[model samples]
Target: MLRRISFYVVIILFFLGGCSDEHGTSPTSFEYEALPAPGNFEITSGSYSLTLSWDYSPENIALAKEFFVYVVDPYQYGGNIYPVDTLTVAEYNTSKGCTFDKLAANMEFCFVVSAVDLSGIEGRRAEAECGTTSAP
Candidate 1:
Protein backbone atom coordinates (compact mmCIF):
# COMPACT_ATOMS: atom_id res chain seq x y z
CA MET A 1 0.00 0.00 0.00
CA LEU A 2 2.90 2.37 0.78
CA ARG A 3 4.57 1.70 -2.59
CA ARG A 4 1.28 2.23 -4.45
CA ILE A 5 0.70 5.61 -2.74
CA SER A 6 4.24 6.78 -3.62
CA PHE A 7 3.74 5.83 -7.27
CA TYR A 8 0.47 7.79 -7.40
CA VAL A 9 2.19 10.85 -5.83
CA VAL A 10 4.96 10.65 -8.42
CA ILE A 11 2.42 10.52 -11.24
CA ILE A 12 0.64 13.62 -9.85
CA LEU A 13 3.92 15.50 -9.57
CA PHE A 14 4.83 14.68 -13.14
CA PHE A 15 1.47 15.94 -14.46
CA LEU A 16 1.69 19.14 -12.45
CA GLY A 17 5.21 19.87 -13.69
CA GLY A 18 4.15 19.28 -17.29
CA CYS A 19 1.27 21.76 -16.87
CA SER A 20 3.55 24.53 -15.60
CA ASP A 21 4.21 27.36 -18.09
CA GLU A 22 7.81 28.26 -18.81
CA HIS A 23 7.16 32.00 -18.78
CA GLY A 24 4.63 31.86 -15.93
CA THR A 25 2.39 34.23 -17.91
CA SER A 26 -0.46 34.00 -20.34
CA PRO A 27 0.50 33.09 -23.90
CA THR A 28 -1.66 35.90 -25.29
CA SER A 29 0.14 38.62 -23.37
CA PHE A 30 1.97 41.11 -25.59
CA GLU A 31 4.18 44.10 -24.89
CA TYR A 32 3.84 47.29 -26.90
CA GLU A 33 5.52 50.67 -26.53
CA ALA A 34 3.31 53.72 -26.21
CA LEU A 35 3.58 56.70 -28.57
CA PRO A 36 4.90 60.07 -27.50
CA ALA A 37 2.48 62.76 -26.34
CA PRO A 38 1.54 65.70 -28.55
CA GLY A 39 3.70 68.78 -28.23
CA ASN A 40 3.45 72.59 -28.49
CA PHE A 41 -0.21 72.66 -27.45
CA GLU A 42 -2.01 75.96 -28.03
CA ILE A 43 -5.56 77.14 -27.41
CA THR A 44 -7.71 80.01 -28.73
CA SER A 45 -11.00 81.18 -27.30
CA GLY A 46 -13.98 81.85 -29.55
CA SER A 47 -17.70 82.50 -29.22
CA TYR A 48 -19.10 79.47 -27.46
CA SER A 49 -16.14 77.41 -28.55
CA LEU A 50 -12.45 76.88 -28.22
CA THR A 51 -9.88 76.11 -30.86
CA LEU A 52 -6.95 73.83 -30.15
CA SER A 53 -3.74 73.65 -32.11
CA TRP A 54 -0.51 71.74 -31.75
CA ASP A 55 2.61 70.92 -33.65
CA TYR A 56 2.26 67.70 -35.58
CA SER A 57 4.50 65.80 -37.95
CA PRO A 58 4.56 62.39 -39.52
CA GLU A 59 7.92 61.79 -37.95
CA ASN A 60 6.41 62.63 -34.56
CA ILE A 61 4.26 59.53 -34.66
CA ALA A 62 5.70 56.22 -33.52
CA LEU A 63 3.51 53.10 -33.64
CA ALA A 64 0.44 55.31 -33.43
CA LYS A 65 -2.40 54.00 -35.55
CA GLU A 66 -4.91 56.80 -34.80
CA PHE A 67 -5.58 59.92 -32.75
CA PHE A 68 -8.38 61.36 -30.57
CA VAL A 69 -9.34 64.52 -28.74
CA TYR A 70 -10.22 64.44 -25.03
CA VAL A 71 -12.06 67.22 -23.23
CA VAL A 72 -12.76 68.06 -19.63
CA ASP A 73 -15.62 70.17 -18.27
CA PRO A 74 -14.15 72.02 -15.35
CA TYR A 75 -17.50 73.14 -14.03
CA GLN A 76 -18.50 69.56 -13.44
CA TYR A 77 -16.97 68.37 -10.25
CA GLY A 78 -15.05 65.11 -10.49
CA GLY A 79 -14.95 65.64 -14.22
CA ASN A 80 -13.63 62.68 -16.11
CA ILE A 81 -11.75 62.66 -19.36
CA TYR A 82 -14.21 62.51 -22.22
CA PRO A 83 -13.58 61.87 -25.86
CA VAL A 84 -14.98 64.69 -28.02
CA ASP A 85 -13.71 63.61 -31.40
CA THR A 86 -11.90 60.83 -33.20
CA LEU A 87 -9.13 61.69 -35.62
CA THR A 88 -8.04 59.49 -38.41
CA VAL A 89 -4.44 59.02 -39.36
CA ALA A 90 -5.01 61.02 -42.55
CA GLU A 91 -6.70 63.92 -40.80
CA TYR A 92 -4.07 64.04 -38.13
CA ASN A 93 -1.40 63.97 -40.78
CA THR A 94 -2.84 67.08 -42.46
CA SER A 95 -4.45 69.17 -39.74
CA LYS A 96 -2.86 70.56 -36.62
CA GLY A 97 -5.99 72.07 -35.10
CA CYS A 98 -9.49 71.10 -33.86
CA THR A 99 -12.41 73.04 -32.42
CA PHE A 100 -14.81 72.32 -29.58
CA ASP A 101 -18.13 73.98 -30.38
CA LYS A 102 -21.56 74.48 -28.78
CA LEU A 103 -20.08 74.98 -25.37
CA ALA A 104 -21.31 77.34 -22.66
CA ALA A 105 -19.92 80.80 -23.05
CA ASN A 106 -17.49 82.09 -20.44
CA MET A 107 -16.77 78.58 -19.25
CA GLU A 108 -13.28 77.14 -19.33
CA PHE A 109 -12.35 73.77 -20.77
CA CYS A 110 -9.28 71.55 -20.67
CA PHE A 111 -8.04 69.51 -23.56
CA VAL A 112 -5.78 66.53 -24.23
CA VAL A 113 -4.95 64.58 -27.36
CA SER A 114 -3.86 60.97 -27.34
CA ALA A 115 -2.71 58.41 -29.85
CA VAL A 116 -4.06 54.89 -30.14
CA ASP A 117 -2.35 51.90 -31.61
CA LEU A 118 -3.84 49.12 -33.72
CA SER A 119 -4.25 47.00 -30.59
CA GLY A 120 -6.70 49.57 -29.16
CA ILE A 121 -4.22 50.78 -26.60
CA GLU A 122 -4.00 54.52 -25.87
CA GLY A 123 -0.63 56.16 -25.52
CA ARG A 124 0.50 58.95 -23.28
CA ARG A 125 -1.71 62.03 -23.15
CA ALA A 126 -0.53 65.47 -24.23
CA GLU A 127 -0.08 68.13 -21.60
CA ALA A 128 -3.42 69.58 -20.52
CA GLU A 129 -4.32 73.01 -21.92
CA CYS A 130 -7.17 75.16 -20.63
CA GLY A 131 -9.08 77.92 -22.46
CA THR A 132 -12.15 80.02 -21.74
CA THR A 133 -14.84 80.71 -24.30
CA SER A 134 -15.91 84.26 -25.22
CA ALA A 135 -18.42 85.81 -22.84
CA PRO A 136 -21.91 86.56 -24.13
Candidate 2:
Protein backbone atom coordinates (compact mmCIF):
# COMPACT_ATOMS: atom_id res chain seq x y z
CA MET A 1 0.00 0.00 0.00
CA LEU A 2 2.82 2.48 0.79
CA ARG A 3 4.45 1.79 -2.57
CA ARG A 4 1.17 2.42 -4.35
CA ILE A 5 0.71 5.71 -2.56
CA SER A 6 4.16 6.91 -3.59
CA PHE A 7 3.50 6.01 -7.19
CA TYR A 8 0.22 7.89 -7.18
CA VAL A 9 1.82 10.98 -5.66
CA VAL A 10 4.53 11.06 -8.29
CA ILE A 11 1.95 10.70 -11.07
CA ILE A 12 -0.07 13.59 -9.72
CA LEU A 13 2.99 15.81 -9.53
CA PHE A 14 3.92 15.08 -13.11
CA PHE A 15 0.48 15.97 -14.35
CA LEU A 16 0.52 19.27 -12.53
CA GLY A 17 3.98 20.15 -13.75
CA GLY A 18 2.93 19.90 -17.39
CA CYS A 19 0.29 22.61 -17.03
CA SER A 20 1.03 26.36 -17.18
CA ASP A 21 0.09 29.60 -18.85
CA GLU A 22 0.30 29.82 -22.64
CA HIS A 23 3.64 31.58 -22.36
CA GLY A 24 5.17 28.39 -21.09
CA THR A 25 5.87 30.07 -17.80
CA SER A 26 4.39 29.71 -14.35
CA PRO A 27 0.62 29.89 -14.30
CA THR A 28 0.42 33.07 -12.29
CA SER A 29 -2.13 34.37 -14.80
CA PHE A 30 -3.88 33.10 -17.88
CA GLU A 31 -4.24 34.84 -21.23
CA TYR A 32 -5.07 33.88 -24.78
CA GLU A 33 -2.39 33.55 -27.43
CA ALA A 34 -2.28 35.39 -30.74
CA LEU A 35 -3.73 33.82 -33.86
CA PRO A 36 -1.69 31.07 -35.40
CA ALA A 37 1.20 32.15 -37.60
CA PRO A 38 -0.36 34.92 -39.66
CA GLY A 39 -2.02 36.59 -36.77
CA ASN A 40 -4.48 39.39 -37.38
CA PHE A 41 -4.36 40.59 -41.00
CA GLU A 42 -5.81 43.30 -43.25
CA ILE A 43 -6.58 43.93 -46.95
CA THR A 44 -7.81 46.94 -48.87
CA SER A 45 -8.95 48.17 -52.26
CA GLY A 46 -9.28 51.55 -53.96
CA SER A 47 -12.72 50.64 -55.19
CA TYR A 48 -13.90 49.51 -51.79
CA SER A 49 -12.88 49.10 -48.18
CA LEU A 50 -10.30 46.94 -46.53
CA THR A 51 -10.64 43.29 -45.56
CA LEU A 52 -8.78 41.40 -42.87
CA SER A 53 -8.30 37.80 -41.78
CA TRP A 54 -6.55 35.84 -39.00
CA ASP A 55 -6.02 32.42 -37.51
CA TYR A 56 -7.02 30.90 -34.18
CA SER A 57 -4.09 30.06 -31.95
CA PRO A 58 -2.64 29.65 -28.39
CA GLU A 59 -3.10 25.89 -28.33
CA ASN A 60 -5.94 26.31 -25.82
CA ILE A 61 -8.65 28.97 -25.95
CA ALA A 62 -11.58 28.94 -23.53
CA LEU A 63 -14.06 31.80 -24.11
CA ALA A 64 -13.33 34.39 -26.73
CA LYS A 65 -16.18 36.59 -27.96
CA GLU A 66 -14.67 38.68 -30.77
CA PHE A 67 -11.56 40.06 -32.45
CA PHE A 68 -10.73 43.74 -33.00
CA VAL A 69 -9.69 44.78 -36.54
CA TYR A 70 -7.93 48.04 -37.25
CA VAL A 71 -7.51 49.98 -40.52
CA VAL A 72 -5.37 53.02 -41.00
CA ASP A 73 -2.64 54.88 -42.88
CA PRO A 74 0.64 56.46 -41.83
CA TYR A 75 -0.03 60.10 -42.70
CA GLN A 76 -3.72 60.62 -43.49
CA TYR A 77 -5.51 58.50 -40.94
CA GLY A 78 -5.82 59.52 -37.31
CA GLY A 79 -2.81 58.20 -35.39
CA ASN A 80 -2.30 55.69 -38.17
CA ILE A 81 -5.18 53.81 -36.62
CA TYR A 82 -8.58 54.32 -38.17
CA PRO A 83 -11.92 52.74 -37.55
CA VAL A 84 -11.55 49.86 -35.15
CA ASP A 85 -13.94 47.02 -35.93
CA THR A 86 -14.92 43.94 -34.03
CA LEU A 87 -15.32 40.61 -35.72
CA THR A 88 -18.25 38.72 -34.24
CA VAL A 89 -19.35 35.39 -35.61
CA ALA A 90 -19.60 31.79 -34.72
CA GLU A 91 -16.31 30.16 -33.76
CA TYR A 92 -16.18 28.94 -37.32
CA ASN A 93 -15.57 32.31 -39.00
CA THR A 94 -14.28 34.90 -36.53
CA SER A 95 -10.52 34.88 -37.00
CA LYS A 96 -10.46 33.64 -40.53
CA GLY A 97 -12.06 36.47 -42.50
CA CYS A 98 -12.34 40.22 -43.18
CA THR A 99 -14.84 42.93 -44.16
CA PHE A 100 -15.06 45.21 -47.22
CA ASP A 101 -18.09 47.41 -46.41
CA LYS A 102 -16.19 48.86 -43.46
CA LEU A 103 -14.01 51.11 -45.63
CA ALA A 104 -14.34 54.11 -47.95
CA ALA A 105 -13.53 54.48 -51.61
CA ASN A 106 -10.20 55.88 -52.91
CA MET A 107 -8.80 55.48 -49.41
CA GLU A 108 -5.52 53.76 -48.78
CA PHE A 109 -5.89 51.63 -45.68
CA CYS A 110 -3.65 49.20 -43.87
CA PHE A 111 -4.99 45.97 -42.39
CA VAL A 112 -4.23 44.04 -39.21
CA VAL A 113 -6.22 41.62 -37.09
CA SER A 114 -5.55 40.16 -33.65
CA ALA A 115 -6.92 36.96 -32.34
CA VAL A 116 -8.86 37.40 -29.15
CA ASP A 117 -8.85 33.86 -28.02
CA LEU A 118 -11.86 32.35 -26.33
CA SER A 119 -10.07 32.97 -23.07
CA GLY A 120 -9.99 36.69 -23.76
CA ILE A 121 -6.25 36.64 -24.40
CA GLU A 122 -5.22 39.12 -27.10
CA GLY A 123 -2.69 37.37 -29.23
CA ARG A 124 -0.02 39.04 -31.33
CA ARG A 125 -1.16 40.67 -34.57
CA ALA A 126 -0.14 39.73 -38.05
CA GLU A 127 2.07 42.16 -39.91
CA ALA A 128 0.28 45.16 -41.43
CA GLU A 129 0.14 46.07 -45.12
CA CYS A 130 -1.78 48.33 -47.53
CA GLY A 131 -3.95 47.45 -50.51
CA THR A 132 -7.20 48.22 -52.35
CA THR A 133 -9.60 46.15 -54.46
CA SER A 134 -12.14 47.16 -57.11
CA ALA A 135 -15.37 48.28 -55.58
CA PRO A 136 -18.72 46.68 -56.40
Which predicted model would earn the best lDDT? Answer: 1
Worst 10 residues of 1 by lDDT: 55-64
lDDT of 1 by residue, 11-46 (tens): 999999998767875678677677777788889999
Report the alpha-carbon TM-score of model 1 versus the true structure: 0.67
Task: Judge candidate 1 at residue 26 and give its lDDT.
Answer: 64
Model 2: per-residue lDDT, tens digit, 1-136? 9999999999999999888556765657655434453443446354565555555643423345566677656676444665477766464264367666745566566766665666666656656777765556
Model 2, residue 11: distance off in Å is: 62
Error of 1 at 85 (Å): 1.0
lDDT of 1: 0.80
In order of listing, the candidates' clash counts read: 0, 13
C-alpha RMSD in Å of predicted model 2 compared with the true structure: 14.5
lDDT of each: 0.80, 0.59
Candidate 2 regions off by >4 Å? Answer: 1-46, 57-64, 76-83, 89-95, 133-136
